[model samples]
Target: MANTTALLFFSLAAFAACSPSTCTFIPSTNATTTNYPGSSFIKTSAYPYNISVLSEVPIATICTSPTGNRTAELACARIYIDAIDEQLAFLYARRLGYAAVAGASKFATNTSLNDPSRNDVVAAGMAAKVLKYGATEAAGAVMGGEGCMIYAALKYEVETIQEECNNKFTVDVERVCK
Candidate 1:
């Protein structure tokens, strides 16, 4: 448990500490673990925020990483920053991001494969959590083919911050991502 916290601090600190020169080329052997935050992040803003929880950034923020290292993590800081100013705004951004991406996906667009199957219903039907995961995987495949550190971190940040938004008020998939 202590080890995990230290690692988190190290990774984030390394990222914070990284400078243009210090953050050089990461080799191909960087970590590929993809255990990012799931979709239940709406809990962060659900409960009360008092001194009792002041020391924490919401336990929901502690995502489950499969197995990662500092190499990719630190590099992520250079590319993406996820410190949204407002919680509801965070959720809105996520919903919009997912909708925009899903709408433009090859399966959703007729311009890509020349196919007529615009399966946007899939996106609309997905639960809030499913939307987050699918978008990360889809974005990662398109953006992280090289397994670059920046892209990996982008995926992680995207998932992590999206977990910190307001829940849909209920898990009814119908009204969740809608």
Candidate 2:
């Protein structure tokens, strides 16, 4: 149990340190209207990513308490951060000009990764893992001790989402589509 926890903690830290840029959210103006100010309209042509599915992991596994019960608190903090991050990313993306469509319907058929919620869900799961493994093992405690990892993950994810949106907007919509 101790070894497993330690491994999880180290892995989360390594991921955070090495993959910081993967999830930063940059502002994009490719999809926006007066209906909202901080919202942008994302068009099909505005999507900059080459869309990949990556790996699949269950949210329950991450959010639920393991043998140590540290994950419950981590899940709470993660959910809070997820709400803030998702809202911010959507608002920022909309503000930058990306419009929100329900999914990959005709309206968003051309959009890359039509579901913003997908990212949030994944982030929430990641937060759970970080809390489960990193917070508990590193601190030998739960809840209060896990706060730092949550904050770190939150900061990293938000920044990555924003960066991705901004970079896409700049390249596809502002530069090419304009």
lDDT (C-alpha, whole model) for all candidates: 0.33, 0.38
| Cα lDDT of model 2 by residue, 74-177, tens digit | 86556545444444454445532322222112122334432334444544565566577545332332221233323333333334443442223211111111
Q: In candidate 1, which residue ranges exceed 4 Å CA deviation? A: 1-85, 106-108, 111-178
TM-score of each: 0.18, 0.19
In model 1, pairs of residues that clash are 41-163
Global lDDT for candidate 1?
A: 0.33
- Over 1-178, each residue of candidate 1 has an lDDT whose tens digit, in order, gives 9999999999977654332223222222221122112224233433323312225334432332346655555554322223222333444345444543432332222233211122233333333334465555444333322233223333433333233221111121111111
